[model samples]
Target: MSTPARRTGRPRSAEADRAILGATRAALVELGWGKLTMGDVAARAGVAKTTLYRRWAGKNELVVDAVAAVFDEHLEAADHGSLRADIEDVVVRFATLLERPETKTALMAVVSEATHDEALGARVRSAIVDRQKRLVLVGRERAQLRGELPPEEDPAAAARNADLIFDVIAGSVVHRLLVSAEPVDREWARSFATVLLHGLAAASSGTGTAPAPEPAREHRQKPAGSV
Candidate 1:
């Protein structure tokens, strides 16, 4: 009789993977890429170094996986009917995510490391670019569907414009995060969205009156003279 084929797949534990990713994010936030070590992650995760190594080839893989997890949880692609709503959703979400101290620290660590590590830079680009592109595509499609964009407008150009809005939102937050040291909240997000929508609408219409102001609420008069 032929010997039974050996099992090829290793049984992996989801719980262990979560712990490892959590540990890796924590380590990156605290120590950054240059100082982070696998041993440090092991200690923080309460897992043996062998267990981590069994799953990831090295620290780079582990860090990349952790960053991916963060993005998956935080950076959602929203479809809110109109392009304006979609842009608002993205800006709001971006602002909210940047306010998280751990997330900010971890992202900064990845960015700093990307300056010197080509592999890490590629990983970062892969993690962020396509996801961002999807958001831009959604915005462009919505604009076309709503007739907000010109019929002759290039989809790629529309997408690029969406990306520009994202750049402003992200740039403003990063500036405050790095310099002013103020935490971004819903109000700030709203303002950013308002500004971005106005700019996009103005660009599309070739008019400055893009983000039409919200109508003022009128106070009701008490029947003739009675207060």
Candidate 2:
């Protein structure tokens, strides 16, 4: 008897990855979350259905990764002089990415599902939110170097601040564009940055000082543990 040929998946290919993700996004915009399927994506991408199955277990996982690829581009920011300028540049780019048909539709679908599915929610946080938060870290470091924001002495506080900053920026933008269905124009980005870095009063009247990180207080070492 002749030995049977072993079935094997196609070797991983960057070209294939690009084709699949691109086709998935395009299909998402056309067929939407409810209608899109792995078979259809493989057909559109011109690859074997097994290829998509090997790469992604299901449509939800694939869709999250596809939309994440769009949101994740904010990681590559160009130097825009002041911290405020950087903030404005990124905000506008972020808003534009959200406005893409596939990004909006896929992201909304996944997020709505994520609310009830813990695993999906965790995937969204790890693959998308956590990765993009590096933007907050980078911007904060630059601001510190330029004396725009005060240096944070407490390591724990620094982490908390970065999380809070990202939450505020991401939350406000998502609400304005997706929830309220308002335009996030350049003017809005500029104004939001001003309010974020400075306070509401400063953004409006230009009088209050920008809130900087509080300086760490000095302790006298507790006089060698004398309580």
Candidate 3:
């Protein structure tokens, strides 16, 4: 006799994936990477430890996935038909994400783990590089399309300016969060964008402006509003 047909059905539940990510983020915030345990994640997720393990190889993998999920959820590329609008949108969204206590805590946890975990470091670098590259490319292309950038304007320089915008914001936020300085909010991001854009536009116009200021130190500090 012929065997019965195998069952065909819809894929896994989206709710479950969200639950796992949510639980993982919560656990990281509460316990941090060193103290976080599979049991804690399972308890927060309201699922069995076996289930959590089945979905992720270990705490590192879970943390990586959680960070990726948070980025995807919060950071969206803005195509506002103009470079300025796009910059504003991205800067605002970035500041908003940094302001989130859960996101900040989770980021610190992942960054701390990356100090010793080579694999985790690679994952973090890949995520950051790819996202930054995408933003720069999109902004540069849009600026070119709008004829805002001069014909002789270097695409690489324009793209690098986009990267610099993020660097400034990240540096300022890190300074506040780690050193207990003033918060890096929307205003700071706007100022960064304004200065960077002014320099790039000046370069394109063939009118040299004052030399840019020296970059700040690499070590991060805690901002006023950080948890």
Candidate 4:
């Protein structure tokens, strides 16, 4: 068989790509989704509009990637030695991200539009929701290792439980922050983690009363910065 000819083109700059995404986030913060434009992002990124379009299909796609990047930046798992502590810690971190005006605004806008747009929905699922779910998996694995949770006889059930936990954690935080227009702070996170831990304990023991979860310690986090 004949070898195919090598394609020739200049390589895209990774630095420029990071700059563009950072610019998109800045635009969202300053102008919001409605007011933001390709020209604005290009100028903020110090790149041509063509450069952005060359990388991303449109504003929606670009914003999705930008939001995903921010989420990735904040998605961290700290081994706090106990399930309750770990859950509370991660929940506080997540709530911190939710509290950000830029992330909150952009995510809700994209999600609202995603209801009607299949491609956007897929992007949000793959980029945002799925990535965040890893927090649940990691926590679950840690809990099992510590004997905080019982071993699963069925892998399918374990997966389902993880999904349910993810939904409860993420959905409650979103609803409280966006719909209820309430703040998700340390107290709220600890309470939520308490309820979650108790439920998991009951499930594992098949009993009405479970041991009280360890009190969650305060987590001091730094602010997110621009690139």
Q: State the displacement of the C-alpha of residue 15, model 1, in Å, after optimal TM-score superposition.
A: 3.0
Candidate 4 residue pairs in backbone clash: none
Candidate 3, lDDT over the whole model: 0.68
Worst 10 residues of 3 by lDDT: 214-223
Candidate 2's residue-wise lDDT over 3-101, tens digit each? Answer: 999878556898888789889999988997789999999999999898888888898889888878877654456557668888888888888888988
What is the C-alpha local distance difference test score of each model? 0.70, 0.82, 0.68, 0.82
Q: For each predicted model, how many residue pairs clash, with residues at least 3 apart or on different chains?
A: 0, 0, 11, 0
Better of 1 and 4 by TM-score: 4
Across 56-108, the per-residue lDDT of candidate 3 in tens digits comes to: 88888787777777877778778887566677677767667766767778777
lDDT of 1: 0.70
Give the TM-scores of the predictions, in the order they appear.
0.71, 0.84, 0.71, 0.83
> Candidate 4: lDDT of 12?
91
Candidate 2 accuracy as lDDT: 0.82
RMSD of each: 10.2, 7.6, 11.1, 8.5
Segments in model 2 whose C-alpha atoms lie over 4 Å from true places = 1-10, 206-227
Question: What is the number of residue pairs that collide in model 1?
Answer: 0
Give the clashing residue pairs of candidate 2, or none: none
